[model samples]
Target: MIDWLNSTALTVFGVGTTWAEVLGFVTGLLNVWLLIRQHVLNWPLGILNVLLLMVVFGTAGLYADMGLQVVYVILGLYGWWAWLYGGAGRSELVVRTTTRAEWLGLAVAGVLLTGGLWLFLDRMTGSTVPLADALTTALSLLATYGQTRKLVESWWLWIAGDLIYIPLYGYKDLWLTAILYVAFLTLCVLGLRAWRKAIG
Candidate 1:
């Protein structure tokens, strides 16, 4: 299994793709599916998915996305705990909507973080798509945080981020990841509808 995962399977846009990317793609699909179902198991599966993707993005020289995987690990753990006990009297968290003030704060923070990360990546790292990666990374942070809070609006942020991620990953030759984001975009739409119904 380990040998197969490390072995090159196909060439995509002059880039050799391995079974590792396939594994990451499968687990990523599972993670998003679980999230849409509001299942707590998504966290552990997400952790595994991100670990695989850390290698994928790192090798692709998408430094910002590589680092985003690390953040996802931390956020996954936090979301796990929050979903289980970060509710009233230690109950499971329920779906909720963000307030206008909260949305404004998130917007400000997203812009600032995207700018900072973009500068850092463009100046310090050998990143090929710094601006796009930084923008998606910043928005993903907000989306993940909102997911932890069980906010219905997080899916919207995810949809926005995934829109950029599809082309970015495709340009980076992470075709599996790009395809995964396409699936993620569809899932985000369904997730938003489901969460909205839950809130209603």
Candidate 2:
């Protein structure tokens, strides 16, 4: 498993892309596509996406992002059940907007969590891009949590995170991963629109 995670699958432009990255790319795209359509299968695919990404990020010394994937594992399990039985009277979840209180809370948490994670990842580890990693880590948690609850704001959070993530992954020389985030950014826009329409 470790050997395969570290094995190069192919090259993009000129950089050798690892098998973990190659597979994460496929699963990540399908996971988000399913989420946009409110498919129950998104959760399971999301679990697979994060597992593969955990390897990719860890190899890059992106400890925060690697840790974020671990958290996603837990969230993925909860999200799976939530989607099916988390609504009122244990029904399928419906699309909804974040309440004002939830919005304010998420804003405050994103800021604080980024600051704290930046400090920890910088001081405690060898992460070269602690600030960017921390920022995306915070947004990712917020987005994933909101998505589990079927909140419309989740797609907004994903778009915000991807805008930061594209450059971060590229600067790290993870070309294929960077390109995947580009697609994710586009998918997030479509997701936001689709979810908004669902609420209406």
Off by over 4 Å in 1: 1-6, 11-15
The C-alpha TM-scores of every prediction are 0.94, 0.98
| Model 1 pairs in collision | none
Candidate 2 stretches greater than 4 Å from native: none
Across 1-200, the per-residue lDDT of candidate 2 in tens digits comes to 97888899999979999999999999999999999999999999999999999999999999999999999999999999999999999998899989999999999999999999999999999999999999999999999999999999899899999999999999999999999999999999999999999998
- The candidate maximizing lDDT is 2
Clashing pairs in 2: none
RMSD of each: 1.8, 0.8
Best by TM-score: 2
